[model samples]
Target chain A: MIHPSAKIGKNVVLGQSVVIEENAEIGDDAEIGHHVIIKKDTKIGNRVKVGDLSVLGKTTSKNKKMARKPGAALTPLVIEDDVRIGCNTVLYRNLLLKQGAFVGDLSSIREKVTVGEDSIIGRNVIVETNTVIGSRVTVQTGCYVTADMIIEDDVFLGPCVSTSNDKYMGEGNYPYQGPIIKKGAKVGNNATLLPGITIGEKAIIGAGATVTKDVEAGKTAVGNPARVIK
Target chain B: MIHPSAKIGKNVVLGQSVVIEENAEIGDDAEIGHHVIIKKDTKIGNRVKVGDLSVLGKTTSKNKKMARKPGAALTPLVIEDDVRIGCNTVLYRNLLLKQGAFVGDLSSIREKVTVGEDSIIGRNVIVETNTVIGSRVTVQTGCYVTADMIIEDDVFLGPCVSTSNDKYMGEGNYPYQGPIIKKGAKVGNNATLLPGITIGEKAIIGAGATVTKDVEAGKTAVGNPARVIK
Candidate 1:
């Protein structure tokens, strides 16, 4: 049941049992699939396609103190024009998925995150809060994009990539921080990026590597500790 | 809508908008959550709990030729007594989740799989086709249990554990055979196990390790190619 306050534009196709809450706005030509839930205050742009069972504008109670801020619902979810969200994806509040961005099935994009235009967040991926992904970035299936990370333009992350946000692990509820994946960098499948490191421009991290430190520009890093091979 | 052929036992509590397909049976005192879909030939045992949006008896088209085998529906999805299926989970047909088994949210278990009694399949975990998990096993969040794998009793797999099939890396589709995690083995977070390798009884695989070879019984392995540390 769509609330009386929802502003659904022309040619919007809502599948079986799509729920649009109060104050939600769906742009023209948007297709929301079966069992989808658009929470209160979500703003979906034109030509957007949200697949079956996707949920947008999920609450950020896990953020603890950040969620208790005054007027939390005032900041709505912004899914820009031509974005494509796959089946069973979940998006939290205050995220901006820019033009032509594609999020794959079963992925989770948490709050305060920005998915750049033409970027691909593939199937089963997780982009935590406070992260920024640049244009045309391809984070493949099952990759875990840690919080507070910056993935620059033209980056390619292969399947099952893992990233960490804390140095001493989560012993102290420490602030999140992670590696900066520079422009045109390529991280191979199943690579693990340690906290606070940086992958230089055009660098390549081989598959199954555990990156311990920073990699220089135009270098190829492989194996555990991930030293530059070239 | 409950199909005419579906047998819903007394005291079964189905939440709003639950769909029970043809030949599906929900045993006594089973609780099904809202928007849950139980497909054809599914059998939910007594006291079973299925969370919201979960789908049971999904087709095994991804199993390729195996899906066309005779009597596919005859080996119906069986959730034994006191089983728990978490939210957004997808369980394929011909799988048997034994009594007291608990599957966490967003997990996917494919066809012909048998999860033994009291096993825990954690959140976001994917257990591929034809795998057998023994009793009291704990496969934590984000663990990928590949096809044709065997995880024996008392095995513990930590978060983000990745297991691969095909030693030649899908060169021939390779028949999909992965490691056998023996009894009482413990695999730490983000560890990758190579194809056909056996994790011996009481063995330990450390975090971020890329295991190329098998670890002997009572051994502790760490690092890339995962040599014995203890």
Candidate 2:
């Protein structure tokens, strides 16, 4: 079911029962699988392979807390060229995926998150709201990138890695503080980065380690509360 | 692109470009949306609304080290009568959704997960393999129920809640050590339930609480390591 207002470019192969909502723009040579939903005001890039049961442009966070009363600004989601989005992936509104980014199956990328060019997000990765992942990064399966973290370029995040942003976890507080991961860092599988900490460039965080403080550049850290290993 | 071997019952309303693979069975009065994919060995129940881009009978966790090998067992997905599956939802092989079960938009239910009768799985919820959810349960938005968890009847799971079964998570390590959530339990938003912990019957888990131990029945748990509040 394609709306009359939906802008579909030439040679776009749409499989059975696809729904293209109003004002959605699909670029040329994009392959959309069956039963996919492209919601309103969404724009899909060229040569993109949108797998089955995938939903794009749904706004996940629309509450009274996010409302600016009447004349507030609303952001749009932009997916750049040659991206491959796997089956059942959900890309909410106000997000941007740069060129050649790959999101594996069953991933949930929340609002305002940006995956930079050529980054690979593996299966079941939950990237929370407003997190920025830089270019050529590899976030492995089951990683949880919590809100407001900055993951710089050339970082490698292993499976089930988790990061938090709030120090007191916003307990009884409204605005929460976030964390950052600098460029060229590597976080191993199941590693936990506590809130408000930063990982410097070229640092290595071992598997299942918990980082409670800032990690220096080119160092390796491990264990709970993470002492510097190198 | 419905295969000739597919069995479509009477009064089925097939939307534009829907694909029903070989041996797939569509029950009476099922409404399939455009571009939906009903892969092989899938059984759709009567009066079901399979939304656009929704995929049924796709692959599950057989490729993972924690799961059974591929071709060790293969079973069809059985979606019972009166189910309303929203757009971009994926039901992999061996899944069973009982009558009146409603899976909201962008949800992914992996292999062998059973949603009991009248259960409502909210938007973007992820149910990993082999989980058994009881009747009339409400799993809210953005929650992740990892593999092999038992959620009893009438449980209420809030947004972004997570349950872990694996204490030591890795390849060849089956992370299914988490305790069951007894009947009528209510887990609030963004709560984390660590491995090997049980939430007793009628227990209330507070928002953003990190639960590391067992919660007694009919109690309210809050804070990190989740002490009983009431």
Off by over 4 Å in 2: A1-50, A53-85, A88-102, A106-196, A199-230, B61-71, B169-175
User: lDDT tens string, model 1, B1-230?
Assistant: 78899999989999998878899999999999998878888999999999998878865431111212544453889999999999988787889999999999988787889999999999998777789999999999988887789999999999988876655432355665778999999999988887789999999999988887889999999988688987
List iRMS for all predictions: 6.2, 6.5
DockQ, per-model, please? 0.14, 0.12
lDDT of 2 at A2: 94
Poorest lDDT segment (10 consecutive residues) of candidate 1 chain A: A65-74
Residue-level lDDT for B51 in candidate 1: 98
Looking at model 1, give its docking quality level.
incorrect
**Count of steric clashes across candidates, in order:** 0, 18
What tens-digit string does per-residue lDDT give for candidate 1 at A1-230? 99999999999998667899999999999988668999999999998988668899998764664522444453789999988886678899889999988887688998888988888886689988789999888776688999889999988886688999888874656666888999988886688899889999988887688899999988998887777776
